[model samples]
Structure formats: structure tokens, C-alpha cells
Target: MTQPIIKLNPHLFFGGNCREAMEFYKSVFGGELVLTLYGEGPPDAHKDPKANSEEMKSKVMFAKLSGVITLLASDNPNNTEAENTGQFGLSLEGSDESIFKGYFDKLAEKGQITAPLIKQFWGDTFGMVTDLYGVNWMVNITANRD
Candidate 1:
């Protein structure tokens, strides 16, 4: 039997200030940062026009700060709605590649796969998803040994 080994990482969700937030953090820690915009995400991730507004399509879809630590973030494309989704999301890091895909498939079943799992410029297999409960999740599998 095999089960996914998951580690929690801080996932941030902003109205549209995700890049700003990551920039600020970078200033503090001075680490390598990688960012992806909403428009860069998979097509399925933009099905919700409200969450993928013209102004938001270019907003930060995912960001990672790898300096003193690893901090993950993104913009809440669904910001204008009545209920604010707040400024945070839960991130999951898996050690095993297979486990990572398994978790992603299971979680995405009843949720929205905001970012289709794919290879990122930062050399990581990553994706973003919003669970059925409206909780945002970011999953990553490191592509190389650091």
C-alpha cells in the first residue's frame, strides 16, 4: 500500500496584490523568486470569468520565494465576489512524485484545478486547485535536488 506523504506550506491568496506581496517578501529575505500569472495558468483554471477578470488574468497566479524559506502565493481571482476568500491558501509539498500526482488527482476530483499540474520554470512540478469547500491549495514536487 502506498500513501502520499504531504507537508504543509503557507499558501497566500490576495485580491490582486500577489506580486506586490511576493516582492515585499523578497526585499526582506532576498531569495530566488518565481511567479506565474493567471493568464499563464492552464485554460481550465480560467473557466470562471469572475475569478479570471481581465484585470486579474495577468495577476499573480502562483509565486514562490526560495530564500530563507519557501513561501507560496497567488492572487484570489475570485476577489470581487460577496464573500472574501481571504488572503491565504494551503500548500502541499510531496516528496514522492507519484504521491504528488495522486493527491492532486484526488483533490481535484471535486474541486477546480486552477492550474493544471505541469513543469514550471523554477524546475518544479506544480499546480493550483480550489477544493469543493472553497479552500485554495497549491501542490508542488521539486524537479531537482537542491
Candidate 2:
């Protein structure tokens, strides 16, 4: 295997909710979503070209974003289990209050708000939430907003 440079997408596998998780990530992180619906895109996605067919196309072979950051997501190949989202979480770090606040509000929507965006003991604006899909996310807004 050769080393791949410049990661274009961050692949995340789900037991069965890859699509939902990806959509939530899109809303949390600013990005354009180009999803390849199963059997809706080309047939060059499968590892085995011969296996590439309409039936395979609709498996969410690829979903990408081209903006501030490139985010790529897709469903589990077939049997791979999604990582323990609780043990692993996606953190959005920045110093912009408005932007961070905007994301915090959206992420909290339909999700459990574990912590509200307020001044923490660390002297920073921070909050935490687990989205509707049970994906844990943390958003920290530094105190020095400028």
C-alpha cells in the first residue's frame, strides 16, 4: 500500500446510520454535501469494478464536501461496526462566538444538550451535546473572541 497525501474526506462507518450521521456532521460543520445515493452515481466506486452495478451504486459509496474543510463520509463497506462514538468524539474548536454559537444551537437541536454554552471554570465558552443520532460532539469557544 502506498501513502496517500492530503486527506480529502474523513471516512466514518456506521452500523446502519451512516447517512444520518453524515447529515448531522454537515449541519454541524460548514460544508457542501455531495452524496452518491445507492445506485444513483457512477459504477466506479466499488473496489471490484466488476462488482460495480446499480445495486451497489446506491450504497453511499461517497459523500464529500469542498469548502473550508473537505469532509468525506460513507457507509460501512458491509459488516464493519461503527466506532464507539462515545469514546471518540468530533470536536469543533474556534474562537468565534457567533459562528460557534450558531453551530452549538443547531447541534443541540433535536439532541440532548449536556452543557449549555456559558462561561466555564476554565474561563472559556464551552458546551456539549449528543445529536439526535446519538453521536457525541463537543464545541468549545475560546474566551478571547476577536
Candidate 3:
């Protein structure tokens, strides 16, 4: 009666200011906007003046393109004179939910888990984690039939 959801999609992962970059990408590749989600997380904090930067707050937390491809991002994750991770990765997705779970679990053994494999607000079974080498990885199994 129950079958694991599958995600047949592609996503792009970026360092910081992903929003601005996505907008730039939109210019390069045209696609009608479907949705843009902003993290309620207080990116703006008086503790650090950088956090209060008007321009930074407006950066992209996450953006979806063409209804299928997704752009995943965060604000540098560095508060102080932090060294830029300066690293990026490409996400791969497919339907077989179980297979992806196994893959993600194994990867997490030596890495960081950003999101656990679970139903997402966007109606998809999704999870994100970084590998031991500090590479971000996203796995999604679609819950939405569409």
C-alpha cells in the first residue's frame, strides 16, 4: 500500500548569495518563476554587522527553476573573517527512493547532515548532507505525482 517516493529532478548547489546568482542564471536561462522560499532563520543579526548588511539579507536562501530543477544555497555560513569554502557541487536525482536513501546514509556516516530524509514542505521526500570532504549532496524522492 505504501511505496517510497521518487524524485526525478536536477538541482544546483551554490556557496553564498545564491539568490543573486540564481537571478543571474535566470537571465542566462529563461524560465517562468514558480516559487522562491526564504528561510526564517535570522540571517540578520545585530551581533555581527555583516549579518545586518541590507544587501546580504536579500540574498537567496533557495530558489526553484522551471518547476523541476532546484537551486540550493546558504549565506556563506561564515560569520567572522571566515575563509570562503569556495567549493560547489552538482546534485543528482532519480526516482528509486530506497536506493537514494541507502546512498545518502552511507555518505552521512562520514559527513554532515543538513536535512534528514523526510517529507519536505514542497511535497517531496528530500534530504541534504555534506560528505566528509566537505561537499554538499542532496537526495530527493518526489512525493508529488506531478
Candidate 4:
């Protein structure tokens, strides 16, 4: 029997900083970045008058980065208090230690490293970092089981 293909992508919400954050990710991951501004949408799409304002129009309605990884994000037009707050983290695992370590270092530039990347007892290099945008990430370079 064959199983269906499944892919999980992380979607983030920012407070008027979606473009900046997404751009940063593009720089780190070297992906194709596509951003759709609120003003690009239909005029009557939003019932709230504030949503039609210039500020809102300049905000990122949708942002996507596709390459080494696929990431989606958007600005919160409703001004809600949306935060990651350690609830969950994006995890990356692979056999290439150098590649994963490079990602971990780049992500930890202006961010804090919750855990240093090192060879663990389980026989893999593991680490964690919270990026400048308050997004948590985990990287694990798996060792060959054979």
C-alpha cells in the first residue's frame, strides 16, 4: 500500500513587520520571496474602514518564502496581540551537519541561543535558537544509524 504525501508548513503572524521578518528569512534561507500587500486586494474586501487606510494598505497581506524551506506569514490587520511565546518551535532535521549548523549560526545572529549546537548523547548535533522575530527553531543533524 502507498501512503498519501503530507507536508507541514509554518505560518506566522506579525504586527506590521511581516515584510521585514520575511525578508530576513529569505536572506537566511536564500529562497524565493513573494509578498502581497494589503492594497493589492479588492477595495471592498475588508468591511473595516481602518483596513483601507494607507498604513494598512502598505502592510503585508501575505508573504511566502519557498526554497530550502517553505514559510508563510502575514501582518495582523486587526492589531491583535499575537505572539509565539514558546508555544511551539519549527524543527529541522537532516544528515548534513554543516548545513544545519550554518543555519543555526545564522539564525542566532541577533537572537538568543537557548541551547548550543553540540554532539548529543543520542549521537547527533542538536541545538535551539529563538530568532530576532521571536520565532523558535530547532536543528538536529542526525547521525548514521548504520
- Record all residue pairs in model 2 with backbone atoms less than 3 Å apart, i.e. clashing: 38-57, 38-58, 38-59, 39-57, 39-58
Q: What are the runs in model 3 whose C-alpha is more than 4 Å off?
A: 1-86, 144-146
Q: Give the local distance difference test score of model 2.
A: 0.69
Clashing pairs in 4: none
Higher-ranked by TM-score: 3 or 4: 4
Q: Kindly indicate the candidate among 2 and 4 with the higher TM-score.
A: 4
Candidate 3: give the clashing pairs: 6-142, 7-142, 19-60
Note each model's CA RMSD in angstroms: 15.1, 5.2, 12.3, 2.0
lDDT tens readout by residue for model 1, 14-97: 666677667765654468999988777666576678655667778887899996457888877667332345355667776678
How well does each candidate superpose onto the true structure, as a TM-score? 0.48, 0.69, 0.40, 0.90
Residue 60 of model 2, lDDT score: 66
Which regions of candidate 2 deviate over 4 angstroms? Answer: 1-9, 37-56, 79-84
The candidate that achieves the highest lDDT relative to the unseen native structure:
4
Candidate 4 weakest ten by summed lDDT: 78-87
Write the residue-wise lDDT of candidate 2 on 40-141 in tens digits.
645574576533654444466677766655766666555345455565566777888998898888878888898788889987888898777666778898
* C-alpha positional error of residue 54 in candidate 2 after TM-score superposition, expressed in Å: 7.4
Among the numbered candidates, top TM-score falls to 4
Local distance difference test values of all predictions, in order: 0.72, 0.69, 0.56, 0.88
